[model samples]
Target: MFRRICLQLHWLIGISAGLVLAIMGLSGGMYSFSSELIQLIDPQITRVSPSNAAALSPAILLEKISQHSPYVSSLSLSDDPEQAARVGFMTPQADSGAKKFEQQYLNPYTAELLGKPASEDFFRVVLNLHRKLALDQGGKALTGAATLALLLLIISGMYLRWPTTKSLNWRSWLYLDWRLSGRDFLSRLHVVLATIAMLAYLVFALTSLSWSYEWYRKGLNALLGNDSATISKTANASRAASNQSPSKALDLAAVWTSFRTEVPHYQKLILLLPSGSASTVQILYLDKQAAHPYANNRMVFDAASGVLQTHERYADKSPSAKLMASLYALHSGSFFGSAGMLIMMLVALLMPVLAVTGWTMYLSRRR
Candidate 1:
């Protein structure tokens, strides 16, 4: 009876989510090695000369790019030291009045602008489509639904994999017969691979869902005591103080230098430039010597006065916050480096097989 219940749940979940899972799995598989693919497709963009004593300032780089296109939006620096620095700007469309945003590569050492890429650049388009679901409303919804379904599939899959029989045999648990018929062989392979891929699928699904669904994100935030109301109140208080009088301008470079000096052991530094009305610069540093990359330390600096706003070493984060942050790293397989990424790729590849095998099983049973 228990086995029968498990099979029914598994089949129902698989059938409902199969097509969406296949699409997400294939797209995710493509994105697994996107960094390498980007390098291979556009070697020039990835190339960077050694930084000289006269490295370009962020303000100067932004200023030069603003000359050609005045509608400057946001600028981001690549964390990868090997890659050329990038500045993005919003420019007025030539044919239409609408604004369009694009990224430009720069030589950090010389601050020289490189040639703009053609609109048809392969890797850029692929990553955009993969991330934003082809920039279509329907596509995004479909992907979101797929992510939710993936979560259900993982739950049902685990139930199915749980050992139900009293007698434990190697053949039943692990072995697949080479001499078996094609249908049987495929079924065994699908079940085994799905079992192995379950945890990865769950991590990817939850993270994607957190991005896609507001309720999930809010719920997660609430669980971590990071309620939206608290954030809003904090922002409002900060804004009120700023409105009272002009705040002192903060030196972003000095803030970064101070952070580095304070945390001398960190290997990588990521600074997120503030946008909209926000007045804080978030700095994240990765300690390579740490057991896990997700445990990297983080600090926030006041954009106006360069005063330390928040200092949250990964170890200091609330348990729930730490779990959520770790999920981000795990979903991308960066938590475990190259081996983890390769494992994730293999799991992604097996998803299609699982879907195909599931349908085959259904059809055979109906016959």
Candidate 2:
């Protein structure tokens, strides 16, 4: 009776979330290589041809950029001589809703504006579609529910599909019988593929929790000893609370040298100018040698003094923090390295196939 109940519940949940999961999977597969794809589709918005001379001093580049355009929100630096740095302009307070900045690619060597990046808008749309069908909060809620449902579906399906014969019929459980056709073939494919894809689905669900639930995110950080509020407090204290006045304008040359001494071979380093007296000048860098994207790490520097304030090294993170950070990579299948990403992409592409086949089998049964 209990097994029967689980089987029904699994079917019920799968029916409810199947379409949503399918959409998520399709969109996710597309976005898994978003950074690379965007660049490939349009290199002007992302890459830069390297120059013989060293790139301009950070401060000089900012001054030149400001002269060329009104915005000066933040900028990125790359070690690759061929890649241009990126700069963003702060949106006027009046230009409201879901954005406060627009990005422009810049040639760091000459401080010349390349062009306004367009791929950002495309990804934003994909994000909306993936997160909530572009419905904002309502969409987020729906997707959150779908994520939970999919998780339950996985659990129930596994229970119902558990092997019972000698050695649990390893061959039957692991591989589809090629001899079957039509609904039998589709059903076997759905079951076997879903089983194979369960780990990726679980990773997607757990990682997605942070995007959908504030409480879950806070709880996760706290559990992982990375309470954001506590970190903020520590950051404030480190900002030198006694000195309320803003520090002098930073010399980027000195800062760059300092940063290089720390991370000598970063792929790209994003340096955000301080926004307020209490703010830290932020640095986000991905080491060129890192095996995956999760190695992109963050550092905070004293706004006035340009001294290293705090560093969040990927290697030093706690297990939970490490897990949380790995969520993005896991979702894209980069967690297992390049080969894993390929597997991840395949799973995403197969989601819609599974959904369609499963639903077809369901309808056939009802008939």
Candidate 3:
């Protein structure tokens, strides 16, 4: 009786939430390769011809950028000379809703503006569709609920597909019987493909829940022994301290020098410039030889005096801290490596297939 109830709930959820999950999955699959896609699609704007001379200092680059545009938020510099330096800005929209993020590339060697990458806007739309269905706050809540439903669907589907002791075998669970036609083929395909993609979907649902639900995020941080409140308080205190004095022009070259002195070798680095009254410049960088793509080392430097205030190396972090820091990488499957991301993308692409098959079977049953 309980199993029957579980089966019914699974069907109901699959029909109700399946479409949303499919959309999310499709968007996610596309976004997983966003960086590569952007570079490929807009190489002229995104890439640069390498020069033998050193790239312009951050100060000089910022000065040149400021001449064309104001309110620069962050600057990303890559050790790969072929990559253009990206400068980011957050501008308020006319509707006064969410701020729009704009990014422009600069020739690191010459400090010449290299108009925005065309693919950036496309991916931004894809990301918004995945996260919020492009409907803003209402969409966020719907996606969160759909994610919860997906978690339930995965669990119940696994339970329903569990084999008895005598029937337990790799072939029984994993093999797809293609000889069957119509409903039989779909049923086999749905269960077998879902079983194959189960772990990846679980990772997607679990990691994505943090973005959708505040309670889930807080609970996760708690589980990981992260004190979010304390971190918030510390940040507030830093901002408050910075607010005490009027904002002044920053000597970015000295701060960049201080950063280089602290960490001599890096693959790529992003300098988060201070905003408003804040005078603390934050630098996040990956070492030349790092554990993974997301293994970021952070340093906080005083914008005024160019003195290094604090440095936090990814290697020095505790296991939980490391896990917390790696949530994005884990979600994207880049934490496992390139092969993991490929697997993740494949699984994500399978969501629409699963949904279509499941719906077809359901309609056939009703008929």
Candidate 4:
């Protein structure tokens, strides 16, 4: 009776959310390779010929950027010598739709503006399609619903696909028998691939819950015995909020130096200028092997006092924080680096293929 119920719910949810899952999966798969491909699209602008010379210091780079642009909002460093330094500039209007701040690459050695990279436009479209479905708030809600449905599908699908016996042939369950034809072939192949890809799908689905539901996020936090780890601003953010606003024009150079002393070995550093209520100079730093490269770790400091306000590190993260950080890694397959990315990309593509075959099998069964 329980198996019958699980099967019915699984089929119902899969049919309802299959199209959305496929669209999201395919787009996500493509985006797994976006950054590298984006740079390659316009190498002349995005990539500088590897310089034998050391790149400019953070202060020098920011100063050069400030002179050219209205303000230096932040900057991102690339380990690759060929990669141009990404600098942020404030626009007249807040970014209601696109890139957080208008970003352009600067030739790190020369401080020359490289304009926009080619992948900016392409990623914008793909990201919009992935996140908001090329629409607005309504689209976000729809996608969120689809994500919730996917979570349900994972839970129910696992129950329905449970092996009848522990001794069931592992080969038959794991691989397709090409000798079979028609409905039998589709059913067997679908089960095998679905079973093989379930773990990847499970990771994607679990991570996606945070974005799709606030309740789920809060619940996850509660369940994990920690505060929300999705976005931590302070060093002891797991304990209390300590984002101090030091009202004054920040000395970018000093902030950069302090960071150099604090975190000598870092992956990428982004320095955000104080604004509005946030009078602290927040520097976001990621370790070379941080699970989520960009968003996981941060160090906030008082701009006026030059006193450290908060230092959020991945290693210092609580269980909830670790799980939250793992979201990006799982999503992009960056957890395992190149191999993980390839596996995730392939899994993403397989989502739609499975959806189609599963749908066909259901139809055939009904017939």
Candidate 2: pairs in clash = 48-82
* Clashing residue pair totals per candidate (backbone < 3 A): 0, 1, 0, 2
Candidate 1: residue 160 lDDT (0-100): 72
lDDT of 3 by residue, 1-367 (tens): 9999999999999999999999999999999989999999999999999988999989899888887766577789998879999987665567875556667888999989899877899999999999999999999999999999989999999999998576689987888887899999999999999999998888888888887877887798799898878655654654443223223658888998998888877899888777666878888899987777899887888888889988889999889778877878888989988888898998999999999999999999999
lDDT of 2 at 151: 78
In model 1, the Cα lDDT at residue 53 comes to 62
Candidate order (lDDT): 3, 2, 4, 1
lDDT of each: 0.67, 0.75, 0.86, 0.74
User: Which parts of model 3 are misplaced by more than 4 Å?
Assistant: 91-100, 231-247
The 10 consecutive residues of candidate 4 with the worst lDDT sum are 238-247
Candidate whose TM-score is highest: 3
Regions of candidate 4 where Cα sits further than 4 Å from its true position: 50-53, 94-100, 229-248, 288-296, 365-367
Q: Which stretches of candidate 1 lie over 4 Å from their true place?
A: 51-54, 71-81, 92-100, 115-135, 222-312
Predicted candidate 4 versus true structure: per-residue lDDT over 1-367, tens digit per residue = 9888888888888888898888888888878888888877888888887667888877677666766665556677766677788877655445563323467888888888889976778887888888878888887888888888877887787776667788767774687789999999998888788888888988887777777777887787788776654343333432221122123466666776777788877767666667545556776777777665635577777776556777877788776668666777767788778999999999888988988987998898899
Candidate 2 stretches greater than 4 Å from native: 95-99, 117-120, 222-228, 231-250
What would you estimate as the lDDT of candidate 1?
0.67
Error of 3 at 253 (Å): 1.3
C-alpha TM-score for every candidate? 0.78, 0.88, 0.94, 0.87
What is candidate 1's TM-score against the reference? 0.78
Question: Model 1 — which ten-residue stretch has the worst lDDT?
Answer: 239-248
**Per-residue lDDT of 1-367 in model 1, one digit per residue for the tens?**
9768867877887888787677667767777887676666676765676654655655566456656655444444544556776555555568987756566667766667775544326656654565556767777777788787777777767777767788766566577677878678778877777776778888788777876787887787787777556645644553333222112354666665666567755555545555446677666577657546657565778776667877867777677766766765687786798898888877887777889999998888778
